[model samples]
Target: MDTFRKFALNIAVFISFFSGLNAQQTYFEGVYSEKKIIINNPLSADLFGTCIHRITINGEIYPFNISDNYLEVDLSLLSIRKGELFSMTIDHESGCVPIIYNKNDFKFKEGVKFISLKADGNKLSWQSQSEVLLSSLLLELKFRDKWVKIAEISSNGMGNQNYEYIVPFLLSGKNQFRISKSNTKQYYYFPVIDMTEQHYKIASNSVTKHINIIKNNKPAVTCYELKDLHGVIVKKGIDGTIDVSNLKNGFYKLYFDTKEEVIIKK
Candidate 1:
């Protein structure tokens, strides 16, 4: 007919403009200062560092350390990262907490060190070039309430396009904290009730440690064991004491030994 209906309407408008540019939805804008945090990823050379950035207050997790001028992030925690978009300022000399990122679609994959996230059933498996294939990749899933955001994936085979976001936390019985990239600035204190008596007394923010208590799901107690002067293992059931005082401050997770402590209840 008329040239095959204009070649099927020009291949359906070029496959709907290449599926709307692969579903697009990756834009981040920033500008925060106290020392630095100015991000304007007009796709900044297509995601400068390659992506592995992080920021989460109420739930912990705060990892971002790109350098060159600045990009520290974590001003004292306030809950950030809703697809990125900020503008802050306050650098007085060495207050340090800058943050800036417009990093286009994000990408960063060099030698590929580690990227892992697990949870299989509803789906969530993203492993990097190697971590033993991270159990085999299942990809995509984000719910975040009790927590659930597994392997957001992105690697392109290492050239300079690495993006790995793995999140999973639904251990209701509690105990799964994570936050320690460390420059200095820590606060984690939880004790309302549940130590069954072993002696009590806590408050030494020298970056205290050791405080994991999960009840039912497992792991009952352990309290006190701080470390992070570069000693690495930041905190792990510092001494062993949980009475919760009464319970009602909010946020908790202290698994001790194996590692995993993030507490707060004031």
Candidate 2:
């Protein structure tokens, strides 16, 4: 049974009174997944064939069928994507607000847990307690002020599972790491990890021949990348000196170790 990547379907019912005769609203919010979820009588209580005035899903009215005072909710009829915000409001008699019977199914499954995420050397490792079958987990690292997917791992879906991925190199300063199932918004964010060791300096912001990096007031060899204003990497390597003479005269981003600088070729 290949289940979904652990998403939540929330159920909330708040009744408002309007002289005890007006329609009340019930709301449901959650993150959607691909797993086929067909919950019969999700409200647990049978609704009167005509008591339900209207039902809306994601701000749109939802069509439903009622037979023998029973309302069936089949979400598969809609084109909902994973991590998409799902909200539903039902307008009905204030005396009869539908209650969710399967609210437990709208939360993380039993034993599915996010233990810890850590980075060691050039590798990142994390663990989780999982259900029987789950999708692969994504590894995202904050790079250049953006979250970039560096690696991914197929989860074991076992009890107390461990996973690891080797990174090419660390960002060289304060950076963040996280893991997620499918949605980028839904993730386990780790604490900031500072890899900055000694202070580094650029010899010149406007270069004519070469760019020299100084660490602790001395020439330092480090991994560096040079990108144009359009974010195109023009040059990258590991050296204490970068020959920018070949680069066109323009503004360029310099990523030296953990520090970033802007340089002009003049």
Candidate 3:
């Protein structure tokens, strides 16, 4: 994977497509000192097959270079000076889905190279280089328009590293994830990864042996915590279903995503 240099982008604008928002966020802010806008498609294809997209910055067409990933635009060529306010947008074919890594993308060090950030189920996997200055990292999620710290990641304290962590509790809809160094004057962030969404409905409240969850009429990945009548948590996990065959017949409170329900066990 290639590294996109000097960052923090207007990421909230790019995620509107995935969140199914009717009106997209327009990125109209002063340009960062960033020179290159790099994107990675993550699909294996021939160099010649690389897609060519258009970028309109301040209503002017800006040209960029393409590679195995997505595309990289050199802002320097556009004659846009630092601190100059600019509005940018990307245009592509209907079937093409090119994410904006430059949008809402920024980091701590200029020498650091962020390789990639990916989401699988409820776990987040990312890789980075030149992390010698970092001691520990804090993972933050965008909630209610504010960035909130949810987990602390221990850095390897070495350059060129890869790591992963499973989120304890996640929201049901689209979420943005950001990472920052702990207890530092600078709270820089890497490009935000759009976290997974787990929207599920109880297949049944009459718990016979297992509680099933489904999304769009099929099994769905979910984050849930189950508590007994006494308000003591008995089970919690990220899975598609809950098993409670051994528990004695009684009423239990089921907590999932953003909803709570009272379930009857037979």
> Which candidate leads in TM-score?
2
Q: Compared with the true structure, what per-residue lDDT tens digits does model 2 show for residues 86-202?
A: 666666655555655555444434234577877776677777764333566777777656666766677776456777777655556676888877533568877677785657779
Using TM-score as the measure, name the better of candidate 1 and candidate 3: 3
Q: Which candidate order results from sorting by TM-score in descending order?
A: 2, 3, 1
Q: Write the per-residue lDDT of candidate 3 for residues 90-198, one digit (tens) a residue.
A: 5443334566576543233323344577776667878877655446787876654556677788887545788888876557666567766676534544444444555
Model 3 spans > 4 angstroms off: 1-127, 131-158, 161-170, 174-199
Q: Which candidate is the best by lDDT?
A: 2
Q: What lDDT does the true structure give each of the candidates?
A: 0.32, 0.63, 0.60
User: Candidate 3: lDDT of 149?
Assistant: 70
Task: Specify the poorest-scoring 10-residue window by lDDT in model 1.
Answer: 186-195
TM-score of 1: 0.16
